[model samples]
Target chain A: MFDILIRNGKVVDGTGARAFLGDVGITDGRIVAIGPELQQEGRRVVDASGLVIAPGFIDPHTHFDVQLLWDGAAKPALEHGITSIIPGNCSLSLAPLKADDRKTLIGMFQQIEELPPEAFTQAFDWTWEDFAGYRAAIEPALAVNVAPLVGHSVIRLWVMGADAQQRAARPDEIAAMQDLLRECLEAGAVGLSTSFVDVDENARPVPSRFAQFQELDALCAVLGEFGRMLQIVPEFYDTDITIARIDQLAELSLKHRIPTTLSPVFDNRQSPNNVPRTLARIEEQTARGARVWPQMQTRPIDISFSLLRPSLFFARLPGWIKVLRLPVPERMIALRDPATADRLVADVGEDGGERLMGRLVVRGGGEAPDHLVGRTLGEIAAERGEVPARALITLSLENDLSIGFLAANGGHDSTERIGPMLANPLVHIGASDGGAHLTSFSTYGDTGYLFSEFVRKSGALSLELAVRKITSDTAEIWGLKDRGLLKPGFAADVVVFDPQIIARGEERPAFDMPGGGMRYVRDSIGIDTVLVNGEVAWSKGSYSDSATGRVCELT
Target chain B: MALSLQRRFTTPEPDESLESLAARSLPDLPLDVAMEHIRGWNLHIFLMRRPRGLLLGGDVVFIEPPQT
Candidate 1:
């Protein structure tokens, strides 16, 4: 008898083929049969009428490394139909780290993830210091499959200690790092991850950024031995530099005979040539039989911030950063001072930040007034007879510096332009940055947004192709074994969703993190059921107690 | 297929100073001229980073100008 049966759904098999009505049978945590009207008995059954059943989505880039310790499902990620996730991207993971280096790594995590300090201290036990120990700690309660990447920074730290961030590794240190990486690969790490552009909480470059090219090359040699992937956060802001990094990745890929990927290849109005030029380089490199995949997110960039803390949204504006970096009491004094306010306003340019701050909507769920919520700063500024910059300061001072504001679609907003790019076979649809950027924006629902905006709304890609992009394509790119198909004997990781309405819900605040830390989250709209390894993990707006997830096997 | 050339760049050797890197990357020019060219071509390193011009081992120091 089948363990479970999903009946009469439109099966989009993650193969870029046409969908057809079918039933799938599951047993022993794997798909046992998939055909028309599976004539079988089952212990349980799922009615998937009028829904689409596809292979579970794979998110290639995430920082769920620490979050996975407490919330094994990665919270709303599994609810949004992401069954298998690749965490430990961007040169930060929570294992192979010495107990002495824990504080240092926590500072880096705080810098990138913005997770509260209590999350580390209050959430779970830190018993593991090596890759295998870390894996063993989280494996028992997992409800979503994980294919983790060993971090280059942590490996450097394991070998070179404090000098990991200070100088280049010596030849002996590099050899030691190779041995450590080999151990991690054997311990079920799917790949290696490094970063070129991340900094610690103190704004110093992270350890991975300090490594010389030879260091990265030596690490890649270890990865080549295992045929694992190499993921990097390149200098994506600059086109010339990103192209250079691509050339470097291609050379490493060809030389080591392994696949490589870079996150966040964005298309922006300011640098319109970034995507096209990068894709051009990728094509040129791929034609030479080098694997250099560029990852791009489907969702437009949206950033939310308030004056209660220093946020990177104000990064380009030096005066705001300076004032915000001050202590809270002093910062309030600076914002209220006429002389300081005048200088700050003047620094925003002659238009007084209208072009930049005008469209920022006053997000509610904070100290913002009922009437001010959902209203744009431009509109409020006109009513108050002040420029947007001055109004922003005044409004925050009035609200005790707790007013939340959102700059929606700040960049990568051109769905009309991005559609074709996403459809480009060479472009890998990922870089969600999920489980990081928790407070800044909702990183939970890029997959849902892909369906709603791109497939249903813009028709950029057909349903079958979009499924293939995030499923089989992602699985094939990362060398995940047997988890991205609907064939018999494949892992029964699947999602049932309404094709016409599957989407991300409105962003809202959730105080669900350890220590009740608040984060912006989006509810899944039309996902009906999500299955991980043949067990119903999320069904009809609820999570199951079944912990059927395991560490993914690599090819 | 032959990949088209990108802007030429190099990473820093261990504890290498800018003057030394300038000497190594642009050997044909005089020291002062090579340093000036290096500064001009790599604004992200020379201008943008805090403690400006503080070189690191992993920096992608551009040796020539932007191709376009």
Candidate 2:
């Protein structure tokens, strides 16, 4: 007898093949049979008639490293049918870290990932110093499988302590880092994740940026020995730098014989050549037998922020960032002070932010004035006969920074362009930043958006292709063996959903984080059941208490 | 798959200075000329980074500007 059976479903099978009517049998956490009719009885039989049964989606890029300690399913993430997630991205993981350096690593996570301090302070107890201990902490509560990438910054921190961020590593330090990376991999880390663009809370470069190519090469030697993946956050804002990073990644991949991935190659209207050029380089490198995958998201860049806290919009403005980083009382004083306000407004450039922040709509949240909710700052400033920057400052100060502003349509909004780009065989559909970027925007429901926006609307990809892109192709790209297929003997990670009604739910504030540290989440729509290793983790709009997930082994 | 255009850049060696990297990547030119080219092409390093011109390991130093 089987553990469970899914009957009379249109199984798409995650192979980009045509859907077939079949019954899938699951026994002992693996798919035992898939045929038109299975003879074996099951303890649980789900009649998934009229629904599409496909492999559970794999989110290849995420920051569930810390969140997993408290919420193992990464919430709403599992509900979206994400059976497996690759966390520890962008050079900030939680393990292989000293207990004393906990504060420093937490600060780095808060800075780079925009996670709240309360999450670290109030959530689950931090009981780990090594990778194995960190793994032990999160393994029990997981309803979703995890293949964590040990961060390069944390690895450097473990090897060099505070000096890791200050300068390049010595030879002995490099050897030690290699040994540490090997240890992490042996402890079941799927890959190594690093960054070239992110800065710490102090705005200094992260420890990984301090590394010389030789140090990374030494680390890659260890990765080669394990045949694991190497992930990097490149200088994606610059075209030349991105291609340079791609070439560098390709060189590493070719030399080390390991797969390499660079994330968040955004398609910006300002630089039309950016993604195209980057993708072109990716193709060139891939043709040379170098496995370099570029990860791109499906959603447009929509940023929501308020003067109550800092935003990535002020990242280029060092002065604004400094002022915003101050305590509330100090920040209020700085904004009100005439001298400081004058320099800050001047910092918005010659047009006085009319060209930059002029079109920012007052997205209503908090104590925003009712009349100002839908209006742009440009109109308000013009009506007040003041420059946009000064008006923004005065208005925020008057409102006590309670008025939320939205910089919508930031970039990568074009469906026509991104559709074909996403359909490219080499492009990996990820970089959702799902568990990170809490206040910025909702990263959940990207897989749903893949269906609503691209599959159903744009017609760029068929349902089969879209399903395969997020499932089999992702698992193959990340080398997750025995998953991403409905074939017999494969691990039964599956989803049943109504294809037409499948959509990303409306983005809304969810006060579910520790200490009311709010994150925007979208509830899954049209998803029926999600199974992790043949156990129903999410079904009928609610999660099951069964913690059936585990640390997945990479091939 | 070949690109119509791509920028020329160099990854630095271990313990290499900006001058040494420039010399190695742009050996076709004189030492001073190559160093100038290296600095000119990589303003992100010479201008943007704090402790400007301090080339760390893993620094992607460009040797020339975009051809286009």
Candidate 3:
């Protein structure tokens, strides 16, 4: 008898094929059968009428490593139809890290992931020092499948101690690292992740950035043995550097006979040539029989911030970022100083921060005054008889620095320009940064936005094609085995959703983090049910107590 | 299809300083001119970094200005 039979649905099998009326029968956590009608007996039956049944979506790039420990569902992620995730992106993971280095790694997570220090200290116990031990700790509780990438920085730290970030590795040290990487891969690491752009809490470059090209090549050799993936965060701010990285990755892919991916290829209107040039390089690399996937997110770059913490929103504004990085008391003192305030204002140029700060709307549900909450900072500046920068400082000072502001549609917002790019076969739709950027923005709903904005509004990608992009495309690129499709013998990971209304809800603050810390979240909309390995993990806007997800066994 | 060449860049040698990198990467030019051009070509190094121009081993230091 089938354990679960989903009948009378329009099945899009994630092969870029057209949708058709079908029945999917699941037993023993695998899709046992798929056809027009099934004469099945003794099971739960889900009537998926008027709903599209497809393979559960897979997010290729994420920082769900830490969150997976406590919230095994990775919360809003599983509810949004993501059954599989690859965490430990951007050269940071919790495993293969020494106990003494925990504080150091926590500081990096705080800086990069925007996580509170308590997230590491209070959320979970320190249980693992190697990849296998880490897998053991989280696997039993997980409700969403994880394909973790062993971080290069962590491996360096494990092998070279403090010297990892300080200098290049010697030959013996490199050999030791190769051995360690192999051990992690054997222990179920899908691949290795290194970063060129990320930094620790003190603005020191991450350990992965200290490695010479030879060091990376050595690690790639280990990945070659397993035929796994290698993911890197390239210097995406510069077109030439990104292209150079593409060439480097292409060379490694060719030599190693393995796939490699680069995260966060964005489209900036100011530098209109960046993406086109980068994409051209990627196309060239692929044509040479090298696999170099360029990951692009579907959502516009929307950032919410206060002067309370250092935010990447002010990355281009060096002076503001510098002061904002200071400790809270010191930051307050600096903000109050007249010279520092003037310099920060001047950093925005002669328009007195009008062009940048004018359009920022005061975000609600904060310590901001009721009357000022929904108004733009420029409007508030005009009313208060001050420049926008000055008004921002004075208002924050008045409210004890608890006022939040949102810079919506900041960049990469043009759907007309971004639509065709999303539809590009070479472009892998990922880099959601989900479970990272917790306090800064909601990274949970880009998959939903892909459907609502690109497929429905812009008609950039057909329904079946978009499903294929997130499902089979991601699985094939990462070499995930026996998942990302609806066929007999494949893992029974499925999502049933109404095609017309699938979307992401409004961004709101949820005080669900350890120690009651706050983070932004968006609930999923139009998703009817989600199944993880033949068990109903989420159904009709609620979650079930199902711990059926596995650490993905790679191809 | 012929792959068009992008702008040229070089990674720093182990413990290499900006002066050494400039001399090594731009040997035809005078030392001062090479240093100036190297600094001009990579603002992410000379301008954006903390303790600016602290050359790391993996940095992609550009040898020339942005190609026209």
Winning candidate number (TM-score): 1
lDDT of 2 by residue, A1-555 (tens): 889989999888999999889889999899989988888888999888998889999999999887888887889899998999999999889989999898899889889888998888888888889999999999999999999999999999998999998888999999999999999999999999999988888878889998988888899999999889999999887888988898888989999999999998879777898888888888889888899999999888887778888887888898999999999999999999999999999999999999889998876535668788778999999999989999899989889988888887678999999999999999999999989988767889999989988999999988999999999999888889888988888999999998888988976667788988777788999899999999999999989897989899778
DockQ of each: 0.81, 0.57, 0.68
Question: Candidate 1 residues A235-331, lDDT tens each?
Answer: 8889998998998899999999999999989888888988999999999999999999999999998777899999988888899899999999999
TM-score of 2: 0.87
Put down candidate 3 lDDT per residue, A318-378, tens digits, no spaces.
8998999999999999999999999998898898889989988887657888789768999
Residue A110 lDDT (model 3): 93
> What lDDT score is found at residue A90 in candidate 2?
92
Q: What is the C-alpha RMSD of each candidate to the true structure, in Å?
A: 3.0, 4.7, 3.9
TM-scores for every candidate against the unseen true structure: 0.93, 0.87, 0.91
Q: Please tell me which model should have the higher TM-score, number 2 or number 3.
A: 3
Best by DockQ: 1
Interface RMSD of 1: 1.0
* Worst window of 10 by summed lDDT in candidate 1 chain B: B49-58
Model 3 whole-model lDDT (C-alpha atoms): 0.91
**Model 3 clashing-pair count:** 0
